[model samples]
Target: MVYQETVAAIKQLVRDGVVPGVNYAFIDQKDVTRGLFGAEQLIPGYEPLKPNQLYDVASLTKVVGTTNVILQLITEKRLALTDKVSDFLPEWQDQRVTIRHLLTHTSGITGYIPHRDKLSAAQLHDALLTMHVGENFEVKMVYSDVNFIFLGWIAEAILGQPIQTLIQKRVLDPLRMTHSTFQPEDPTRCVPTEVSPTRGLIRGVVHDPKAFVLKNHCGSAGLFSTLDDLIRFEQAMLFNTGQPIATHWLTELTRDQTPLGKQWRSLAWALLPTQLPVAHNCIWHSGYTGTFLVLDQTTQQGMVFLSNRVHPHAPNEAFLARRNAIINTYLAEKTVSSKTE
Candidate 1:
C-alpha cells in the first residue's frame, strides 16, 4: 500500500537522523493503517517504538481535546459562541473577547505567556486575564495559546470541574479513547520528547513548559495519546452527524469562519493549505512535538503523524518542512488514485 511505502520513508528518515522515531496512523473512514518505526529513545539506551505508545501531542490539545470539550458544551447549551470573557471571569469583562474568538484564535491575545515559572496552575486563569490584550485584538487572527488557555478556564467555571475531568467524562470516555489523556497513567508507554536542559530526558510528561507548570493539564497544550485513539477521534470528527456531537455543529466547526486570506480557521480546525492535494475540503492542525493531523471532509479521510523530532534538543526550523513533505506525499498518492477512479 502507498501508506506502507510512506511509512518506509519515515523509517528511513529516522534511520538517517531526520527524527528519533515516528508513530503514525491514517484513517480513510473505513479502515486504519498504523506503524511504529525507529527507537523510542536513543540517548542512554535503544528502545523500540511501540504501536500503542503515547506522545506529548502538544498543541493538538487545542483541537482534539479542548475543541471537543468546547463543542460539546456549546451543543448542550451550556456555552455560546457569543459568550464574553467577562461573563465567565469578571476581570476581562471589557476585553470584548468571545468564546468564538478564542476557538478561532482571533482574540488578539498574546500567542504565549511566560508565566509558567511564576504562577501555579490554579493561578494561570487570573494571570491570563490580566495579560495585555494586543492593540489589534479581535481585528485579525493571530494563533495564540492564550486563547485556548482562557477557554479551558471558562469550561471549568461553567462545568464546576477541572478541564481534565470534563475531558475524561465528556470526550475521551464516550469515544472509548482509552489511551488518550492529559496526564498519562503509565509513563513507560509514552515516547520521550526533548532532553531539556532543566527537565532532562523527558518521557510521558508533557513537553510544553506552560503545561508542565500547570499540573500536566492545560487547554492550550498537554495531552498524551496513541495513534489508535487519534484515529477514533478523526472518525468521530468526520462522521459525527448523529453521534456525540451534532452534525450541524460539526459542519460549522470545520467550515471556514475567518475571512478569506486571513489565516483560514474554522471553529478550531485550521483550513488545509489549498496548494496541497485534496486540501480544498480539508482541515488540519499540528502539535509542537512534531505531530500533525489532516482530515478531508470531502472524502472522509484523515492522517495522523506523531514523532519525537526533538529528542536530544529542540529543532530550529527543519521539522515542519519534513512534516509537510511526508503529509504531501500521502496526499499526493491519494490525489493520483482519485483521478484514476
Candidate 2:
C-alpha cells in the first residue's frame, strides 16, 4: 500500500533515532486518510504512544490556528490583508507594515521578544504598544513568531474574545475536535512534552517559553492536538468550506506568495512549486518541535506528523528531508499515473 510504504519510510527514519515519536494522520477528502504510526514518549523507557496521544503543534499553530483566525477576520471584513497592521496597533504605524506583510512574515520585525517571563497578556499587549520595531533588517519573509503573536491580539480585538476561545468557537468546535485545545490545563487527556531541569517531567503543559509566559495562550506556539484533529483541520481547508472563510482569502492563505530561496511560502504555508516539478498544487507547513504536515489541494489530500521528536534532545533535519523526499515521490507517482492513464 502507498500508505504503508510512506509509513515505513517515516518509521525507518524513526527507528534510526531520527525522531522520538511521530503521530501521523492523512485525510483524502471522502476517504478521510487518517492513521497513526510511531513510537512515543522517547524518554529512555516509557510505554508506547497511543493513537490518541497529543503533541505540541509548534509553529504549525501559525499555519492552522493563527492563519485560520486571520482569514475569519477577513471574512468578517474586520481586517484586510492589505490593511496596515498599525491601524490596529498604531505603534506599528510608523513602520507602515500591512497585514499581508505580517502574514507573509515580511514585516521586518525582530524574531522574538523575551516578554514571556515578565508580562501578563494585558501587560504584554501594553508592552507591545510601547516597544519599537527594529530598524536594521530588510523587509522580506523572515518567518518570525512575533508577527503572529501580534495578529493574535488582532484576532482578539476583532472577535472580542481571546485567541484560545476563538479557536474553540471558530475552529475546534466547528470541526468537532473534542480532544484538542489549550491543553495541559485539562490534564486528564494530555501527554507530556520534555523533561527539563527547571520543569521536570513536563506533562500536559506547553514547552514553548514564550507561550509559557502567556500561561500557554500565546498565538504562535500554544496548541496541543492529536494527529486526528489536525487531519480534520486539513480536510476543512482542502475542501475549502465556504461558511468559514471567503474563497479567495482561503486561496490567499494557501497560495504561494513569497520567494523562499527555492520554495515560496503562502500566507501561513509553504508552496511546493510546479518546479519542484512533482506536484502541481502542493503547499505545506512544518512545526519546529518535531511536527510536520503537507496539504496537496489538487489531490484533496493532506498528511500530518505530530511528535515530541525533540524530547530529551533537539530535532534533526533528517525527518524534514525524508518527508519532502516522500512527498515529492508521491507527487511523482501521481504524475506518472496521469501519463499512463
Candidate 3:
C-alpha cells in the first residue's frame, strides 16, 4: 500500500497530461515493487505501457553507465580522480583540468554544444578538447555533459576498447544488468522519445544528438534501460557486492567532493540534503528524456522513475516538482513508521 499511493499519484499525473508514460520501481534493499501507467505510444496508435519497456534514460547514462565505468577504472588503479585531462588527450595538455573536475562538472567546459551538425566526429573530439574552461575551473561545479563525454574518451583510451564495450565488461556484465545497454538490440521494446523533425520518432537510438552523432556510444548520454535493471544497480551501490567496484570506492562515489553549492554534488551524483526528519540524505540524477534515479544510502532504499515525457512534444522544463514530491512522500512514510516503532 505504501507504493500504491505513489503509483496512484503517477497515474493521476499521467491522466492530467503531465507525462505520457511512466515505468517506476522502488527498492528497499531486497523488497521491490513497480508499476506501469499511461500510453507508451500515443501518436500513431494507442499502446499500453509495459513494465519491461526500455527508456532512453537521457543524462541518466552519465551516472548509471558512464560514471560506473570511471569508478571501476579508479578502483582498478587504472585512473585517478586527480589525473589531468591533458594526460589522456594531448590537445587538452594546456588546460589544467583533472578527472575530478570533470566528474564534479567543474571543468569550466560548456554544458552542451551543437556539435552533431557543426563538426565531424574527429572535429568534435578536438573541439571538446580545446574548449574554453572557466578562469576558476577547479572550483565551480557547472554540471556539464562535456565532462562526461571526455571521460568516455578516456575509458576507451585506458581500456583499449570502445566505451560501450568497457561498460559491458566493467559494469553491465559484472552487475548482471543484462537489460541495460548503450544500444538496445530490440528496438521495438524501447519506449519512443520525442518526435523530432530531424530524427523523427526516436526509439531504440539515443535521444541526445551529440551521442547519436557520435554513433550512440558517448559517456554523457546514449543509454537505454528498464526500471528493474536500475533497481539492481541501486542495490549494487547500497550493498557493494564487490563485483564491479570496491565498497570503499562506492562510498567515495557518494561523498561530497565540491563545496561550490549548498547541496554540492559527489563524483557523478547530485546530492539532495533533505530537511525532512525521516531521511537526512538523498542523492539523485536525471535524464533529459524523462528518467531519474534517487537513493537514500542511509536507509539502503532507492527508486528509479522512467517516463517518456518528451513524446508528442518537447517541454521547456521537466516535472522536477513532481519528482521531489514523489520522493518526499515515499521517504516521509518510511520515516514516520520508523519513528512510531
Candidate 4:
C-alpha cells in the first residue's frame, strides 16, 4: 500500500498500453520494495514481466555508468572538473569546453551530424570531436548526449581503458550490481525496447542509435540493467556506501554544479524542482527506453522505474506527459508523507 498513488498510475499506464509493463523499485537506507507489472513482450509471444529482466536503460548510462567512472577518476585526483576537453583528447578542438561544462550539460557543443546514425563508429567519434560550441555555451542548459559521449572518451583517455571496462570495474563491481551490464549475453533475459527497422526487435543490445553504432565504445548510452541492480546502485549513492566514489565527491555529484545556476543540474543528474524556494534534494535521470531513477539525498530514498515504452513502437507526447504525471505523483506523495512524519 506504500506508494499507492504511484502504483495506480503505473497500472493505468499498462492498461492504456502506454508501456507494455514496468519493473520498479523504491529503496531507502534499510528497505526496498520491488514490483513487476504486465508483459515484457507482446508480439512474438505473450510473456509476463519477471524479475531480473535486463533493460536497455538508454541515457541512464550517462549517470549510472559514465558519470560514476568520471567521479571515481576525479576522486582519485586523476581528473578535474576544470580540465579542458582538449587536455585529454587532442582531437577535441574546443578549448573553451571543460569537464564541468560537459557534466552539467553547459558545454553548448550542439553540432548536428548529418545521418549521424549511419556514421561508422570511427566517423562518429571524428564528428563529435570536430563539433563546435553553440551560441548559448555555458549560458543555457541543453541536455545533449554529446556531452556524455565526450566524457566517456575523456575517461577512457585518462584511464587508458575502454569506457565499458572502466564502468564495470569502477561502478558495477564496486556497487555489487551483478545484473547491470553493457551487452547482456542472453537475449531472453533482456527486455526488448524498439522495433528498429534495421535491427529488428531491439533486445539484448542497446536502443540508442549512436550507442548502437559505437557499441560499448561510446558511453552516452548502451547500458543494460535491472530494477534490483538499480536499487543497489541507488542505495549506494543515497546512503554513501563509499566504494566506487568517496563521500566528498558524492556530495559534489548531488549538488547543483551549473555554472550560472540558471538551470539546475548536478554533476550528471538533474535536480528536480519543488514548490519550496529551495530546490528539492532529489537528483534524477531518465533513459530514452522509458527508464528513470530518482534519489532523494535528504530523505535517503530512491526510486527506479524501468519500462519499455518504445517497445514495438516509439512513444508519443502523450506517453511522455503521462510518464511525468506518474513521477510527479510519486514525488507529491513523498512530500505529503514527509510532512506528516
Candidate 5:
C-alpha cells in the first residue's frame, strides 16, 4: 500500500476514462512497487492490462535510448558534448550547434516540414538537415524532437551502424533492459496507442509520425518497453551499477546543464518545476504516448508511468490536466516522505 495516494489517483484516471489503463512502477534503492490498472485495449477488443506488456514509450526513447547511447559513447571517448553537429553531418549548416546544445534542447534549431510524415526516410533526413537555427539559438530552451532525431543519426554515424543496433549494444543490453526495443517482435504483447487515420489502430508500431517514417533510423521516438524493463533502467541509473554510462556522466545528467534564466534542463531530461530543494536534483521526461519517467537522484527514488491516453482517439486538455495532477500528487507525496526520513 505504499504510495497509496498516487495509486488511487491513477485508478481514478482510468475510471474517468482519461486513459484506457496504466502500468506503473515506483522504485527506490531498496525495492520496487508496481501496479497495473484497467485495460490495455478497449476499442478493437477489450483486453485486460497485464504485467510485462510493452508500451510505446514515445519520446522516452530519447532519454532511454538515444541519450543513453550518446553518453556511453562520450564515456568511451568516441564523442564529446562540444563536438559540432556540422562535424558529423556536413549537411547540417549550423556550425554553432553542439552535442551539448542538442542534449539540453538549447540548439535553437527551427523549421517545419509540411506533411513531414509523408516524406520518405531519405527525404525526412534531408529536410531535417535543412532546419536552421534562428536568432534564439542558444538563448532559449526549446523542447524539440528534431534535436534527438539528429542525435540518433549522429550515434549511427559514429558507430557505423543503425541506431537500433547501436542502442541495443550500448544501452539496452548493457543495462539489462531486455524488453526494451525499437521494434516489438509480437504485436499482441504490446499496448495499443492511437488509432491514426492513416494507420488505423497503432499497436506495437510507433505512434510518432517522424519515428514511423524513419523506422529503425529514428532517435526522437519509437521505443516499446515494459514497466519491468524500465524499472531496471531506473535502478541502473540510481545505483550506477551494471550500466555502460560512467558515474560522472550519470551524475551530470541529474544536474542542471542550462543557464539560470532558461527553463532548467538536465542532459536530455527536464528538471521538476517546484521551489523544493529536492526538485532541483529531480529529472524527468515524458513520451507523447502517455508515458513518463521521473528520477530523484538525491533521494534515490524514481517512477515509471505508462498508459495509452492516445488510444482510440487523441487526448484533450482535460486528459493532460488530470495526468499532471497525478504526477504532481506523486511528487508531493515523495517530498513529504523524504522529509520524514
Candidate 6:
C-alpha cells in the first residue's frame, strides 16, 4: 500500500526528532484506517500503537465536540449565527457579538488564555473577563479561542447541560465514536500524550494545559480520540441528500460562511471554494495537534491523519509538506475526478 510508504516517510521524519509522535487515519465512503509513527506518547517500552489508542486531538475538539453541539442547537432553533452572543449569555450581549463573529473569530475577543492556558473546562468562561481584544489590524479576522469559549457557555445555557454531556448526546452518541471523549475516561486504552517531567505519562489525560485546567471539557480544545473515531465523525456530517440534516441544518452548515481560510464553515465542516469548475465539493478540516482530515465529497473519498506532533516537542513544519504530498497521492490513487467542474 502506498499509504505504508507515506507512513514510513512520516515515521522516518519523526524518528529523526522531526515530530513527537504521529497518528493518522483515512476514509472513503467505505473503509477506515489509522496509522502511527513515533513515540511522543509512550516512551522507553517500544509499545506498538493501535487503532483504538486515544491521543489529545487538540483543536479537533472544536469540531468533533463543541462545534457540533452548536450545529444541533442551531438546527433545533435554539441558536442562530446572527444571534448575538449575549442572547444566550447575557454578558456577551454587552459586547454585542454575534454567532457569525464568534465562529469566524472576528468577535473582538482577545483570546481568553495562552495557547497553553486556554482550557477553561468548568469555569464560567467569562470571556471578555480576561481577554484584551488585541490591536485594530489584528481584529480583521482574529482566530481567537475565546469565541468558542463563549459558544460553549452559550450551548450550555440553551441546552441546560454540561458541554461534555451535550456533545455525547448530540454528536458522539449518534456517531458511536467509542474511542472518543472530552474528559479522560479510560486510562489504559488511551495513548498517553506527553512524558514531560511536569505532566508525567499523560495517558488517557489531555495534554493541552488549557483543556486540563478548564475541566478537560472546554469548547476550544480538550478531547482525546483515535483517528478512526475522528473519521467516522467527519463522515457523519455527510449524511445528506434526503437526510434529516442535509435538507435542513446540515445544508446551512455545509455552506461556506467566509473567513475560514477561504472556505465557508458551518460548525465543524469547511467547504472549499473553487475558482474554476468541478463536480462534487469537498468538506475538510485539520487539527493543530499534528492532525488533518479532508473529505472529497466529489469522489466520495477522504483522508485523515493525527499525531501528538505538538507533544514533548513542537510539530515539524515539514509534516504539512508531507501531508500535502500524501493527500495528493491518495487522491491520485483513487483516480479522483472532480464532479464540481
Q: lDDT of all the models against the reference?
A: 0.78, 0.68, 0.77, 0.85, 0.86, 0.63
Q: 1-341, model 5: which lDDT tens digit per residue?
A: 28889999999999998899999999866789999999999888899998889999999989888998899888888899899999999999879999989999999999878888789999999999998898667778989999999999999899888887788888888888888888888999999988878899989888988888899898888889999999998888888788667788777876778643356898899877644553456788998889999988778889999998898898644677887788899888887777777
* Tens digit per residue, CA lDDT, model 4, 297-334: 77777789999989888864467888889889988887
Worst 10 residues of 3 by lDDT: 109-118
TM-score (C-alpha) between model 4 and the true structure: 0.96
**Tell me, what's the RMSD of every candidate?**
2.5, 3.3, 2.3, 1.7, 1.7, 4.1
Q: Which pairs, if any, clash in model 2?
A: 26-33, 184-204
Number of colliding residue pairs in each model: 0, 2, 0, 0, 0, 19
TM-score of 1: 0.91
Model 4: lDDT of residue 287: 85
Query: Candidate 1: global Cα-lDDT?
Result: 0.78
Q: Can you give the lDDT of residue 188 in candidate 3?
A: 89
Where does the lowest 10-residue lDDT sum fall in candidate 4? 273-282
Ranking by TM-score: 4, 5, 3, 1, 2, 6
- lDDT (Cα, tens digit) per residue for candidate 6, span 1-341: 23565566667767766565677666655666667666644464556565557777777777677776787677787788788776677654345567877776666665434444443433435434455445532236545566776787788888688777777777777778876777666786766555667666666776666556766336777777777777776676554422224346544554656444343554455565432234334656666666666766544556777766655444457667766676656555444233332
lDDT of 2: 0.68
Clashing pairs in 1: none
Per-residue lDDT over 1-341 for candidate 2, one digit per residue giving the tens place of the 0 to 100 score: 14666676667766877766567766655575555555666565565667777777788877767778888788787888778767776655455666776677766665344644566666666555554556523345677777788888778767677777777777778787767878646653555666777777666788776777764356888888887777777777789763345677655644666433333767777776542224465777777777777877766666777767657655555667776776776555544434543
Output the better candidate (5/6) by TM-score: 5
Runs in model 3 with CA error above 4 Å?
111-118, 259-263, 275-280, 316-318
Please write out the lDDT profile of model 3 over residues 1-341, one tens digit for every residue.
25666777788879877788788888766788787888898876777897788888889878877888898788789999888888888777555788888888877775245544667777777667767776657666687788898899988888888786777777888888888888788888999988888778888888877787676347888878888788888888877664466677656655677646443778889886654454365778988878888887766678889988788778625466776687777766655544554
Query: In model 2, what is the error at residue 71, expressed in angstroms?
Result: 1.2
Misplaced by over 4 Å in model 6 are 1-12, 33-45, 111-124, 127-139, 239-254, 259-281, 315-341
Ranking by lDDT: 5, 4, 1, 3, 2, 6
Superior candidate under TM-score, 1 versus 2: 1
